[model samples]
Target chain A: AQSVTQLDSQVPVFEEAPVELRCNYSSSVSVYLFWYVQYPNQGLQLLLKYLSGSTLVKGINGFEAEFNKSQTSFHLRKPSVHISDTAEYFCAVSDRNSGYALNFGKGTSLLVTP
Target chain B: DTAVSQTPKYLVTQMGNDKSIKCEQNLGHDTMYWYKQDSKKFLKIMFSYNNKELIINETVPNRFSPKSPDKAHLNLHINSLELGDSAVYFCASVDRTNNSPLHFGNGTRLTVT
Candidate 1:
């Protein structure tokens, strides 16, 4: 079975500061990586996805993530964050051969303060 | 219009009662799924349907049943709901062929008291 691990449970940063949420996955075969964000009282939304070809994937809200196959990591990063960027971010992985059911990690809470 | 929509955005009911949450997707995706978000903010897949056929059924309790009338709609019915069943349930859909991104509904917050 595949699983995702998010090292940071909570990350606090000031507005306009850069942020990075670390994510690592364990899988036996090729995998697809994704990042989803959930705002307060709302459902999860796709931030970005890495299917193939590109190692660096850019997402909405000026966020981006790089897929490192050797390290088994897909860490989400943003050069600068706004207060509106504060939310819970989840890292997920799906085996290429398996169905579309995603394996999500325990979300990382991003708190951006002014 | 909402890409994915679930009825009764907030449902509060007593324990032992039965309730159903209806979900519909306008994106015309062939795959739909039900995910449960617990208090700890862990999202787990409960059920998945492809073209109105059950594809993946996780180790969820039998009390939680999912029915897909067609490729565009999937509904979840819970029997004898318990306190542990109180959480946010999300309905999502995806285009199976392209490995498209999953589109999620706003979610239905079910509270059992």
Candidate 2:
């Protein structure tokens, strides 16, 4: 079984400020990583994914994540964020062991202020 | 058009009542799943179906059953609902053929009183 741990449960930042949401995972074998965002009263949307390619993966809304195999981390980062970026972000992992079903982390709430 | 859609966006029922949530996907994907989101925003996979066949069934109780008449539709029926069952249920689909990302529906908020 695989597990995801989001170091920070809540992140508060101001508009135009850079932010990084930390995520770490533990798995016996190589795995695929993903970040999904959920706005208020909405479904989860894929932000980015790392699938055996370049360590740095770019996603929508100018968001990006880097897969560090040694550290077992795939943290999401944005150079500058907007107010609309406030949402709950989740880090998920998947592999053949779990039949490719994504195992999601608890989630981190990102609150962007004016 | 919505890729994945579920009906009864908001369901409020009393305990011991039975309710059903219907889900459909037009993406022609071969796999569909049911996920539960708790108040704290944690998500847990409940069930998954592929090509109208039940593929994955988590440790969920038998009181909760998932029926897939076809590959494009999956419905969840909860019998004898409890207060603990109050949460948002999301229906998602994915193209298992190619390692595509999962597409999710808006979700159905189930409120048990």
Q: List the residue pairs that clash in candidate 1.
A: none
lDDT of 2 at B109: 100
Residues A95-114, candidate 2, lDDT per residue (tens digit)?
Answer: 87876778899999999999
Off by over 4 Å in 2: none
lDDT of 2 at A81: 98
Q: Candidates' interface RMSDs, in order?
A: 0.7, 0.8
- Clash totals for all candidate models: 0, 0
lDDT (0 to 1) per candidate: 0.95, 0.95
Candidate 1, residues B19-105: lDDT per residue as tens digits? Answer: 999999999899999999999999999999999999899999999999998999999999999999999999999997888988999
**CAPRI verdict (incorrect, acceptable, medium, high) for model 1:** high
Off by over 4 Å in 1: none
Pairs of residues clashing in candidate 2:
none
Measured against the true structure, the TM-scores of the candidates, in listed sequence, are 0.98, 0.98
